[model samples]
Target: MQTSPKPKLLIFDVNGTLLNMDGIKTAINQAYQHPGAFTQWFSWLLQYSLVDTVTKTYHPFSEIAEAALQMTAASLKVNVDAVFMQDILKSMQQLPPHPDILTGLDLLKKAGYKMVTLTNSASAAQKKQLEFAQLNAYFEETFSVDAVELYKPHPKTYQYVLDELNFDPQETMLIAAHGWDVAGAARAGLQTAFIARDGQALYPLAKKPEFVCADLHELAVQLAAL
Candidate 1:
């Protein structure tokens, strides 16, 4: 069997991958007074983000986030005014990195891997979240789909990063917590690592990630072995 070459560029997915979303859950729970409101809001946010992408109509991720929250609230028969929605959206900026993120990033950095981020969040918002979490230093660069005006699971989103880095697809690996994001990178010919956070699973129809680890620290350890 031919061995796969070591990856040169490691692109990470932010949000639930590196940054924990518990803050979001808590905020939604408090504001909506509805059980599972966070899950529903997140689902709607993702759905609409892709809807915009597919329709070629772009809206800032924050805008979509608010809209999704409003929709989620309405579905649960909760009426949230604009001020309440803004407060929920603002919580996104204060999210902290997952417990294993710093250690995992240090392991990769010490191993001399080039790291960057590719997120669906707008560049400004992503930067603020990373900076707030103190994770900005670990990454060499950050890219956002806002640059391409598309969301993940779109082939072009992955292609944009590859083009910027000028690395062969086989020599780059995308690490993400979302199955759809991992599948998108894999479909774009990049190698993939799936960080399966709690309650997250890979899309069964897509190709499997080369590595599936429970947390970033574990994923880092596995990558270091390569």
Candidate 2:
């Protein structure tokens, strides 16, 4: 690990890191009523988001999610119309914060670390999510890939924040629960910390983040020592 000075800002990935996705997962699983529908749909959501970036196209994250759900429905021979798919995805807007989110964010806030959000979701949806989760108050600013019409793990997305937010890459830390996210930040020249949420791990081929923690609370504890 590299010894670095404290960061000026913390960039967070909202979907699975701060906001728990369990509610949305349950909604998808129940709507499809299949054994692994949620997992499959979620995997496709991620794949299509990256596909959007590679193809140089952009759509709101919810649209990609609905498309993924459509694919899952077809694969399982379950028929669902656009309205039903939309209804199922509304669960995403209502996801609750992780149990330790308040404590973790509060610690960072009191310690004088500036915080912000960088999400793939559209600005409107991101607002709804944070409001619903009651986590909107902690962040100083919120960013969406929509600003640049790109998705995460794309260098431009990280760069956009650095430019628009006027922060040095070395002075920003991207904290996320997904391996691809931390890897992306590391390659972007920003510091990173991997929150090892359920079933998440680091990519062996990518530059590793400076910190690997079990959750945001552990991240606070670890950063406190530094």
Clashes of each: 0, 0
The whole-model C-alpha lDDT of candidate 1 against the native structure comes to 0.89
lDDT of 1 at 44: 90
**What is the overall TM-score of model 1 with all chains considered together?**
0.96
Least well predicted 10-residue stretch by lDDT in candidate 2: 23-32
- Displacement of residue 19 (Cα, Å) in model 1 is 0.3
| TM-scores for all predictions | 0.96, 0.95
lDDT tens readout by residue for model 1, 112-171: 999999998999999889989999888888999998899997989988988998888899
Predicted candidate 2 versus true structure: per-residue lDDT over 1-226, tens digit per residue: 5487788889999999999988777767787888699889988999999998999888889889988988999998987678878787787888889998899998888888889999999999999999999998899999999999989989889999999889999999999999999888888999999999887889999987888888899898777666
Residue 78, model 1, lDDT = 84
